[model samples]
Target: MVCGLLRPDAGSVHVTGRPVSTAAGPAKQLIGFVPQDVALYPDLSVRENLRFFGRLYRLPRRRLERRVDEVLDLVDLASRADDRVESLSGGMRRRLNIGAGLVHSPTLLVLDEPTVGVDPQSRHAILESVTRFGEEGMAVLYTTHYMEEAERLCDRVGIIDRGRLIAEGGPRELVQLVAERDRVRLTAVGDLSAYAEACRRLPRVEGVARGGDRGDVVELVVKDARSLLPDLLDLAHQQAVGIRSVEIDEPDLEAVFLHLTGTALRE
Candidate 1:
């Protein structure tokens, strides 16, 4: 809305109680956005990129240089400050992008999939930086498809699907919606679909899902797995299923997603 890129047809977007459509300078100055794609001039060095963004905010010359150095150090890219954007690796470039966003010290930082394709090292660094910003009391609206990342980074997560927010809560609270006390996974041979149907009818079983190829592996959520094991095996046997291996897994976010959506998160 600030750049005339996205506009609300009916509703409105407000920043700091001021409407974003009309409040460009003041509202825009208070918010920093880090897009999913890296947006840096390939020809410019990291320091030069940060300086250019700082000048856009009309930062004082002396203070702007200090802020640039501070942000570079914050992202652990101070050593590579003079390196051209084209020469840096994917992770380094992502860090520079984050650094550029923080140059103006905005109160709110909106990060859109900031760690989409970076290596584990870079991803870890970016997450750490965001955590640090939160610790410093910066309000952040981070959006991503990775549930684990959201669980790890956000204090409260808003789960959006098809442009609608389906669920919003603390990670633990969301996981509790699945009604899963524990999970039991069985690897077997035979008619799994029939066996899964039988498990679904069981009083102890809360949910059932096919795991791997041939539907050989099946995971079940139940109230008490220890007491239900014998009955489950008996059901499999009744269906002419041969159990090869069995393992119990604890419930996590994936189970919650499955329970709420009736589909596996991986799918």
Candidate 2:
């Protein structure tokens, strides 16, 4: 709707002070969209792809050439500018995709899961580039199922579940809405269900569940996991649950997402 590709059924959509409709002339100029899939010609060089997009906005030859080079550098793809899209690594191609959206120097850059299938290194590069874009004052509408990404990158987030905006706030504010405690995860051998039940009875432990792939792990949400660890260990010993590993997780976007949606974000 913000792109004016699809009209809202009920309410209006706006971008950069312009109302979004089927014929959104000025609003379209201010918006840049980068979809999940690479929107580039595999047969074209990175520079060629960028030039192609720049020309779509009717950029002058001199300006388009300069913008293409600048965007290539912005995405850290300057060296790969002449390489064909098919010959580049997954990450490089993804970077080029982002570069294409930036050709017009848009006010609002919208990215949809830009790092979905890239290598860790490429993902890091893409994330860093995004951070810089925001730092430089670009209003980015980044959509991703990755909770950590939202937590780290967004100043404020509006969480949508089943097509509804269920929660909206800064990461810390959203997390505070659902949790006032840390979570302790214990991977152990034998009787995890019994251990979970026992853990639930402990003071300060608000919730407990048997989890993990083999059903050999116990998760506990507690007001203070460290302060309650000794009692947790003693009870595990009493229940004959041999502990293998322990992890303390602070509440984050994932917890908030689970709380509001009753399901994991990735699910």
Candidate 3:
């Protein structure tokens, strides 16, 4: 929708105070979209790519050159302006893709998984660019399956599943929605399913999930984990479960995702 390639089926998309469906050109001009795949012409040089995209937006030659330089500097790709896209590293190509999007000075930037398969260093660089965009007052609609990325980059987040938004709030606010204040993980042996079912029936246990081979490991979310550990152990003992180890994990976005969907985010 932001790129004018797709239209909403029912709802509306707004860009810079103008409705997108009605004011396609003006509204689209305010948006810059960087998709998961790099869209640069591999045959073109970095500067050539920027100049081509800039001209498409009808920016004046002088303004386009200046804007290209500014964005190149912003993305730290100024030194590679004359280099062909294929000559650059994966990280550099990703940076160039980001730089190309900003050449027209769009008010809104939509990045969809910009760091999908880059090296760690390149991924870090891309994240920094996004942070800088927000710092520079650019409204960015960034979408990713990576929870840590969302936690690091977004002031607010909207979690979508199956084409519908399931949760929308600050990270801290969403984590608070789960009733469990704390979580405890236990690795035990012998019929863990029975132990898990028993734990689920316990009063303080808010949720219980079985994992590991033969369901030997279980994660329990509870209102008061520290106090409930004793009762949890007792319940396991009654089922003849042999406790091997125990660990407590802090509640985080993964927990929030699990609580909302009744399945782990990875699943």
Best by lDDT: 2
Which stretches in model 1 have alpha-carbon errors above 4 Å?
A: 1-4, 22-25, 179-247
- Tell me how far candidate 3 lies from the true structure as C-alpha RMSD in angstroms: 3.8
* Residue 114, model 1: Cα distance from true site in angstroms: 1.8
Q: Report the lDDT tens digits of candidate 2 across residue range 1-267.
A: 767778688898778668768783778888888989998999999999999988887889999999998998888888888988999988788888999999989999999999898899989988898999999999999999998999889999999989999999998899897577786779999777777777777778766666677877776667877889999889989988899999999888776765565443554
Each model's lDDT: 0.82, 0.84, 0.83
Better of 1 and 2 by TM-score: 2
Of models 1 and 3, which has the larger TM-score?
3
Estimate the TM-score of every prediction.
0.78, 0.82, 0.81
Candidate 2 lDDT at 65 equals 92
- Ranked by lDDT from best down, the candidates are 2, 3, 1
Encode model 1's per-residue lDDT on 94-186: one tens digit a residue: 999888889999888888889888999999989998998999999888877677788888888876656666888988888777545777889
lDDT of 3 by residue, 2-113 (tens): 5677777787777777777634468878888888899999999999999998888889999999999998898788899898999998889898888888999989999988
Error of 3 at 191 (Å): 11
Better of 2 and 3 by TM-score: 2
